[model samples]
Target: MIKLKGIVAAVATVSALGSSAVFAQDVEKVIEARQSFMQLYSFNLGLVGEMAKGNTEYDPEIAASAAQNLLALAKMNNSQMWPEGSSKADAGLDEMTRALPEMWSTFPKVLEKQDALTSALENFATVAGKDLDSLRGGMKAVGDGCKGCHTDFRAKKEEG
Candidate 1:
């Protein structure tokens, strides 16, 4: 009976460890998805930014498409990508993500930031394809919105 009890205890411990390993993998996947989402944002923003900078010829159609894409992305429900234990402060996440702990600790502040970005994107979409001057003006608000959130919630990249 004692031997059987010991075996049962060992199995429970192993089972717990296995579940932890799975949880860690899940967190990693969530982080990857979040990074991918950011990459998409960067890609679409770059399309408009390059044109606004005069580095790329301002194609109205492309500008409108990219602006609309930004608005669509801003409206996406991506809460799952921000699971609680996935910040840079968490174990094994420090190098994988630049998300500050305050992003979670500050609660609705993040939502406010997101809303600000959404509003900027909505306005930008309306003016982006109108002309070069309008795109430049709209870009300023969009850039400010992104910077506001990053300043408060994202950690600076290490200069390795």
Candidate 2:
């Protein structure tokens, strides 16, 4: 009976440790998702500015639809994007993610900066249908918002 009790206790300890590690990994995944989601959001929205400026010379229908899609994506909630261990502090950033660990260290400031990004998106929505000349200022604002978050929070893109 004593030996059986000892074995059970040992197994329980190992099981608990395993569960803890899994939880940590899950958290990390959430954080990574948040980073990637933001990148995707920015990359797609950038197309709107490019098309508006005639840089890509896209079809008007395609351009307008894509721009609207971008606007909708920008307003997404994305809470699920940040999992338990996803902070840059938990794991170092990857090649494409410029997020610095300090993003997690200073929480509210990052949130405020993120809110600025939303404002840029909303502003971009207003200018999406306009010509490049009309959109330039909004484009700059959106671009600056992206750079602002990335400069400290996100990692630079990895060159191929």
Best by lDDT: 1
lDDT of 2 by residue, 1-160 (tens): 9999999999999998899788766666665677677667667766776775677864445545555666676678775665434544454334324456677677767777678877877876666556555456566777777778778776666688
- Candidate 2 deviant stretches above 4 angstroms: 1-13, 28-32, 58-63, 91-98, 157-160
lDDT against the true structure, per candidate, is 0.94, 0.66
lDDT of 1 by residue, 81-156 (tens): 9989889999878998999999999998999999999999999999999999999999988998889999999999
Lowest lDDT sum, 10 consecutive residues, model 2, at 88-97
TM-score of 1: 0.91
Model 2, position 17, has a per-residue lDDT of: 88
The pairs that clash in candidate 1 are: none
User: Cα miss at 37, model 1 (Å)?
Assistant: 0.6
Find the candidate with the highest TM-score and give its number. Answer: 1
